[model samples]
Target: MNRNTFVPVNEPLLKGNEEKYLLECIRTGWISSEGPFIKQFEEQLAARVGRKYGVAVSNGSVALDASVAALGIGAGDEVILPAFTIISCAAAIVRSGAVPVVVDCDPVTWNMDVAQVEARITPRTKAIMVVHIFGLPVDMKPMLALAHRYGLKVIEDAAEMHGQTYAGKPCGSFGDISTFSFYPNKHITTGEGGMIMTDDPALAEKCRSLRNLCFKPEQRFVHDELGWNFRMTNMQAALGVAQLEQLDKFVQIKRRMGARYTSLLAGIPGIQLPLPRTDFADNIYWVYGLVLADSVPFDAKEAMTRLAKLGIGTRPYFWPMHEQPVFRKMGLFAGESYPVAERIARRGFYVPSGLALTDGQMEQVAEAMRKVFQ
Candidate 1:
């Protein structure tokens, strides 16, 4: 296949009112942060997740930061999270002057290991940041139970998961705070945007303040405390509202893509495909990840490089946070080792599983995989 035909790892499917809403924003001159679309998007997104309130933000990372800040977790505090996630989770805790105590992920679910969470809890533990990895919800019942028992907050990073549920409940419904991203590669695209959701009114107000730079109504620009400029634009929210209207359909397409990839690559030795459904919820196929068996000749990096050469886009899994140079320089998790995370980081890579991917493209991707293996 020609390199021009390369299939991307993930692409947003804009099959709804994106253009229509964007045009409306332009017509009304409400392209910036001020517009009705912002409130509309927030209300719909929060309601979709069964939450009472939502705070729109500039991006997913800052949403996490604001949530941690709103909970009053700071200096001398600790926030436990999965070691095999995007650095945003840890960055938030660290930015708030809290220690990020990382844990290993469950090998099967590729989510934070609940059992390890309690073992890492300390007297100064403030919260457990639960990031739903690759469109699957964390097994939240146990995690929530543990949090309640110890009076710890749960911050749900539902960035990669949309329209996914656990035991028939929405993914974002259980946490003290839940966050979402609307990057182009996510289930929905707003170019770049995110949301923070919660049932707690006080927490919601705090997050809202934190997102808007803590502006006081009585005296504008006279702030009691400092907050970052993390407000989402009305244009982005317009795109999000349009995308949200079609999110359920997008999720169905994602599952189909996963199933197709699984069937097409079934007998490829030394490569493991994602499960269609786990005990918690059906896999939304955020990415059709392939994990090489121990017998494989090369690790995920090498495999991804070869796949790229064959016009197939592949992304390696998150490198274990404990092994990150930046974290090591901070003298955190210095002697700690997460064996499962280390192994997965070495072996895992995801192939094309975009929302806009066609059956033919997936076939090409599978064929390219076979060529690489051969």
Candidate 2:
């Protein structure tokens, strides 16, 4: 590989039935949300995750919003989640007029510290939002136990854990409502889409209604409640249906990429590689991230700059929700601290680990990583 060849942060693998299904959507003129592929994609993905029904939405963020609304978690309610996850998790709760209570992540697994959750529970806490960060599933058993004990709802954010399992159970199966993203960087891509999955038929119907502006079934034009037009188009669902067929293969590819990177970049100084596997689940390498050791002189932004100069694309980790200026101005999480989340946000970054990444590109990334450390 040429030293100047750029290895992107992510790219989707669409060599499966993506083209065929997309063409069918075009030929049939079923490009809208009310197409056959929409239901097919929903059913297929739901079944894959061991859910009784799936509601397709425009994107992952809205899926969270829909799930929060469907669960009837709103004002005066509090939802406990991790400080280390995307803002969408917290935003969903806040948007519903509920308060978001955050817990720090485990240093090793980068998942919510389940031990901290029990202490945070209060009379007003109505739900727990468990977000599986990167590739590792959050320690679910204890979280579920807590939810059961407290009579609280569980919302599983399995956006990065497609085809991933936790102790022989599917990641999405545990939540009252679980959500997934179909971004291009994900294992499967609907170009841009998301889904909400659940075993409860009423919850599933509520999500479907919410996705389409909460219009009444009997009276289509009459609106009873507020909702957003978060419907997923048939074109997107066509891509999703095709992509679902290849999920197992995609998971394998992701695992292999993770393994190869771990082997290639082992023993490098000044950086910490992702833990290859956990007791409950293997790392899917959602993105092959690295954390700068304390000895490193620069932050993740600087590391990303260095990698970019070497033609190796990289991305910084999620900024902690507590540190966001917007949230601070809004008087949320004031004076609260999550050391693990803060440190990782400053020091963490990920290298190329896309499904479309070629072996040559992986080697190129490895070589670039070595040069960066040297």
Error of 2 at 56 (Å): 0.6
Off by over 4 Å in 1: 1-4
Cα displacement (angstroms), candidate 2, residue 26, comes to 0.7
Model 2 Cα shift for residue 180 (angstroms): 0.4
Candidate 1 local Cα displacement, residue 296, angstroms: 0.5
Score candidate 2 by lDDT. 0.91
For model 1, name the residue pairs that clash.
none
**lDDT for each of the candidates?**
0.89, 0.91
Candidates in order, TM-scores: namely 0.98, 0.98
Ten residues in sequence with the least summed lDDT for candidate 2? 1-10
| 129-155: candidate 1 lDDT, tens digit per residue | 999888577888899999999999999
